[model samples]
Target: MIREQATDKRTLKTIRYDADLIVVGGGLSGVCCAITAARAGTRVVLVQDRPVLGGNSSSEVRLWVLGATSHMGNNNRWAREGGVIDELLLENLYRNPEGNPLILDTILLEKVVMEANISLLLNTAVYEVEKSDEETISGIKAFCSQNSTLYDLVAPLFCDASGDGIVGFQAGAAFRMGAESREEFDEKFAPTAEYGELLGHSLYFYTKDTGRPVRFVPPAYALDDITKIPRYKRFNAQEYGCQLWWIEYGGRLDTVHDTEAIKWELWKVVYGVWNYIKNSGQFPEAETMTLEWVGQIPGKRESRRFEGDYILKQQDVVEQRTHPDAIAFGGWSIDLHPADGIFSEKPGCNQWHSKGIYQIPYRCLYSRNVTNLFLAGRIISASHVAFGSSRVMGTGAHVAQAVGMAAALSARHHLLPRDLTEPARMQTLQQELLKTGQHIPGITLHDDQDIAQTAQLSASSEFILTELPPDGPLLPLTFSAAQMLPLPAGPIPQLTAFVTADRDTTLTVELRKSSKPFNHTPDVTLETKTLSIHKGKQEVDLTFDSHIDEPQYVFITFLKNEHIQLQYSQLRVTGILSVFNKINPAVSNYGKQEPTEDIGVDTFEFWCPERRPAGQNMALRIATGIQLFSPANSLNGIQRPTNQPNAWVSERNDPNPALTLTWPTKQRISRVELSFDSDFDHPLESVIMIHPETVSPFCVDEFVLCNDRQERIFHKTDNHQSRSTIRFAQPVETSSLTIHLKTNHEKAPAALMEVRCYSVS
Candidate 1:
């Protein structure tokens, strides 16, 4: 009877889902769009074709999650995708330093399930669209292969986050594919003639070392001649994960329509490469190695780019144009790969670095022909040349975040997706994004509803915290690269860095500054110091007298010495960004190389020696030992933590520390939000990192809130969350309020993220 019941339930059944917004696709962009909308009080139904959520970055494809940082590439100094993407990257860095894809899959799923407003349907692929008119998309029909069920999902607005823009294609939206001519968009790097040829698909494999020796034999289908491929020399049995991103195929055909064919071709290449590594007899190290895993699905690079009110062009990216309606920013270079992919005689790809980070306008996120359709991810409005840069997962995530915010606002206003064209509505969307810690270049947060800005901040005591754990492991400071440090506004006598040198050698250090706070390159040398350094475990100090009136980026160059290594930290804080410069043999920036112009630094293709995980900062500290961490920092409108490590920390053994907010006149407050420092190193993202599983002892355990004469007590049993919102049953009218807090686990020096007061009626 039970088996019969199960079998009957598995039979095909028709179901209907009505939501405010329908997100098609479960990639990073789709997940971000759905989560952001759900958080903003919109009913969202997230439809994913695959069982996992990360798309290419999942266990199936195993591609590294990359963004505007471009693997810390050149000209992308201090650039990171904000909003939901930041949380995901931070969580990944904290939990999976090894970059395990299976762990990441759980994180993405947990993020979706945690949201109350999101209804997720996995293993469901949408195959049909219901159009109300030529411009409107009324609904969609999806089939679930696992359950044998049909779903009719209806929504007022729709987001085409599917990498191939499947929904838009079915709705008859205008789109472009492949490459365009240089004359069409006036892009210098574009093809002389137009063609619909795209970048290809890639398959990756992982290998593991068995305790004992292992043997492998090649199958008949394996490539006998490995010499035919140019990259065969670099292949080793131990090379695994995304290192094989270059093992690409199927660029000569449609990347979306001909996906299965491309995937099979990639499979043959993977087997061929593995056979060469194991049977070529050239690598003795492979005797104990075995193929652990190989990706079945190929990670597709380029596909359909839908048409919107605005099409991002190559000139817009190369010139670094700022849009008036800019909602997100991207700093990756204009990277264009040949249509021939691996078979091409040319280098794998060509990249043209931009002057600086460029803005992505709001108009590019929604369809112009399909009225109710919004586009996210690689499907957004862009010329083929521009898509080359925006197609990156990180940049695409930002695009999705913007679309999600817009969808929420549109649903609330009962308007079409295009209704966001009005300045008032767009400002509301941008402000909401900023409240959630998303940074938009050229935009400042000035929301009047936030009570933190109105209060004068004071603390019980200010003390220097020198006992912080290293952000992560320290990396060697090579001779070719120089680190850029961000300094807060204050006077300093000296700076200190943890270092080690193989032999006694003098280290030259120079402090340079940039005119724009948003830029990464330093222009003027404020001072220079040379220190006689020791061989090992040395704390080097460079003494200087300087005062910065405002927050500034100071570039410190440690001239390369083979034996010398400077220490670094993975801990990230706001207003502080750490970047490095490397020795380049061929370089010309802004027309000249000698006495090089700092502006040209933006054009130099920069590459990080290792993966510079998002939200990392240098380990350099202030030698003066004066406490710089202030409670006032919590209200400075800077939510992102950079290397400087923002947040207020109480002094050791301090008694009765409290943060008080006062208003001259009585203000009605209905809610209070508290942000805690649950190990700033552990960043929150779409996926959670598993390491550092314990909660930070520095979190406040108990607190009493006094709103003038009325007092309320709240107790925190656990201190695991980074953010907490407390809503009073009734509005409290008060001229002043104070939060008296006690540290958890008897840990002294309590830390707090931010205190946000709101009156939501």
Candidate 2:
């Protein structure tokens, strides 16, 4: 191995040392790579140039991390890696309660800090690379901003996760940029053969709410003469924000050659466009929003792709290809931005393959010329057409994870990554991935003696209810306020449930409170249950109850005998009645009063059908409170106006309580609703206590509300809800909150049916 001698004049002093792998970039791919390698027992040194991580999908770019998961509708085979990615989703769900940037940054930072085997270096840039001849990378020269000193990181393997493929390019690895002619990859979307123009870059920006209005002002380079460009005609407020406009490209020559100039021109273009919109009086509300963020560096979408053992082609993507050595999967459509300095409004600007899911082979992830260097993320070896489909940051994250895992395995086995391409070794890697919750298509592992004994269930079922498992560590029992009914003398429970629609549905098991008056003592008790279901099949219903309203909220509680942590693989709820009560009460009566004394408690409850697929288990808990009303006094009570429900609420001194239930798998809930007693009055304000498992520490699914009139209203959480309310949104019904416990922990209260005064008539 070749080593670089530290020179006295280098101005860079070594601050930290010793890591099994040193990932050079702190972007999404680099973060994923570091975390994965660390989780697999490798000490990782993660160096990031920016103060924050997440790169493009960060607060700086304001871009969402789209994936081929159910949430984004791609549902590819490799959508099963749920370790750090899952944690990120949950963090985003909690922090980004409003889906904002600061929350996203917090989530990424949390992941980096929480990992035990990873050392994060922020505000550090890798300016030079240390290599062993032309084949192996030995270490990287990193600069720390605090001391203005340099540090050397030595690792067996290095990943060039930088979108620009800087490490590989500097190491003399073979790489290509732009597009080869259609004749090269036989791609339909390529511009006429040969190396052609590449996609331009953009400087993204954010908008903030300034109480005062501000006018838009054009930048120095704003091209006011859009008369020659027809694409400008299609531009609208919906597409153009103060920050995100591809207004200027090719004005200062090649984007790749003169990126700094391109970035400068793009900024001017953005401000100039905003000026045009303001000066032209195109939008009256334009003055209300101020520029929240302007890009410091242009987010480049296309760049050099390092050549590897296998160059993934468009045909492989079109064929729904699967490979024995497949390490990762990508499912975004072939999205090709214009390279000719002219925007295309054609429908085919982004191309799509007939098959959505595509496999990325392991051979394409490593350098073909460099013996030891590996590449992941957007810099992987692929033809231009194939890169277009796999360049998304989320997909790149998955690739980085797979590549990291492969690298770790190679180091442990004393073998190169190329050796793992053999079928048997690939199978071993696949098995290791599955063990860590990474999803591989057409792969399954057996932990038991009988394969035919797996439980089967339906995805369209209205509800699943069952008694807590009597024994076994796989499913623990919890006894709480709700009662548990034993399973009937049948293969499955004898619960009767049906659905009117035949679409896919989800079944959720929860511990809920029965509708009743709240008292000081605990009056409800429940037992936890363990049900079993097959991986993908939804079970048929034993029967149906027509008397039950559509979109109803179902609640059932699982009792925890001990503090046992549970995780669910999947959950779904369907055919449950979703009720929204708009109760407008006269808060003027309580205006001048010092606020009523602690009122009596209220209760709501739902049943857990005693029968469910065997081996299927769930978790349950409770939260309670009531929305108090006071009109003029924002100091004493949480209040909303009579006309608008979306305004803010004030919490005087009292806060509510919350309870969380964690399950065994990532599942979808079928039905959810709130409950209220007859003593409750209208102009109902605030959801006091909600007990959906979705609000717990694990799950992060989005919730929507539809009233009896089929009208939908989106819910936003306020300060009161953040500190006092149990769950942000009511699931589907009002009757399930009464059966759970009402703890006086200053945060728990009885559940409320609705806060608004208007009915859905």
Q: Could you say which candidate leads in lDDT?
A: 1
Scored by Cα lDDT, where does model 2 land? 0.49
Per-residue accuracy of model 1 over 496-515 as CA lDDT, tens digit each = 77778888988888776654
Global fold similarity of model 1 (TM-score): 0.81
- The candidate maximizing TM-score is 1
lDDT of 1 at 664: 79
Candidate 1: where are CA atoms >4 Å away?
1-12, 73-78, 92-98, 191-196, 463-509, 523-551, 561-579, 582-602, 605-630, 641-658, 663-670, 674-753
Per-candidate TM equals 0.81, 0.59
Each model's lDDT comes to 0.72, 0.49
Poorly placed runs, candidate 2 (over 4 Å): 1-10, 69-81, 192-196, 209-211, 226-229, 233-257, 340-348, 446-761
lDDT value, residue 62 of candidate 1: 78
- Output the lDDT of residue 620, model 2: 22
